[model samples]
Target: MVDRLGPRYASTLGWLFATMVSMLFVYRPPLSLLMLFLWKVVGLLPRAVPPVVIARKYRDARASVLSAFNAALTLISLAGPTIIGIVASTDPALPSILRATTLLIPIVII
Candidate 1:
């Protein structure tokens, strides 16, 4: 897939796929289960593509780019749930937390 699509497009597609799937979590229907199932099938691309994209995109600054990427991932893993939890408490709605989480998605996408 990466060979045909290229790292940039493949990674973008992965992120877009993730965004669409994550939004479905708010729905909580029989369809949501289908979406979750689809995600489990395709989620590997995003995890595998990003490092290749970062490596190619920042060829000269690979070390710093990786460091920054790792740092951001660390921050997201720690902070994402916390932000979602706080918003979920005040509003008790999925959309509210989705909105908050969407703010961070762009950071990773860029």
Candidate 2:
């Protein structure tokens, strides 16, 4: 797919699909296990394409950029739950906010 469409389009579509999966999670459709399964399958590309793109684009600085990327991921993973907990405790609209944010953030980022 990347070979055919090139990395830019491929990554954009991959992320759009990911954003769709996130929306499905928010909306709670039927047969969601199927969506989840397909998401996991398709999610591989979004996880992988960036580093591979970075590797190709920044041959010399690939390690540094990838390391920084991984570090940011780690920090998000560590901080996300604590922040969620704090917000969930104080905010009555926490679920709504989570749903909106989850849906909106990826779209904006994409």
Candidate 3:
């Protein structure tokens, strides 16, 4: 399936998948927490796809920069849930905690 799509399509698909997984995190934290393992799977796709596409289409320096950006993004994405969990657990009001968590989503997405 991936071979048929080409690297560009594969990379775009990775972005789409990541975006969808991220949306799940925002819309339903409980469900997102339950499907956290799937996030790991989606996360791996971008790590592999972007570097391959960048190296093919651009110079080494450009590819390296893109790879670095993706790596930093992945790190931030990994940290976000843990931070949200800590906040949600520490807070007394569930709604307020959820609202706080939702606010972080846009920052992460940006």
Model 3 residue 71 distance off true place after TM-score fit, in angstroms:
0.6
lDDT of 1 by residue, 17-97 (tens): 655554444332223354445444443345546786745544545445445655655554444334433433343223444
2 or 3: which has the higher lDDT?
3
Question: Among these predicted structures, which one has the highest lDDT?
Answer: 3
Q: Compared with the true structure, what per-residue lDDT tens digits does model 3 show for residues 21-86?
A: 754554443333424453444344445567767445445444455556556656556554545444
By TM-score rank, best first, the candidates go 3, 2, 1
Better of 1 and 3 by lDDT: 3
Clashing pairs in 3: none
Ten-residue stretch with the least lDDT total in model 3: 29-38
Whole-structure CA lDDT of model 1: 0.48
Q: Please list the residue runs of candidate 1 whose C-alpha ends up more than 4 Å from where it truly belongs after superposition.
A: 29-110
TM-score, model 1 to reference: 0.29
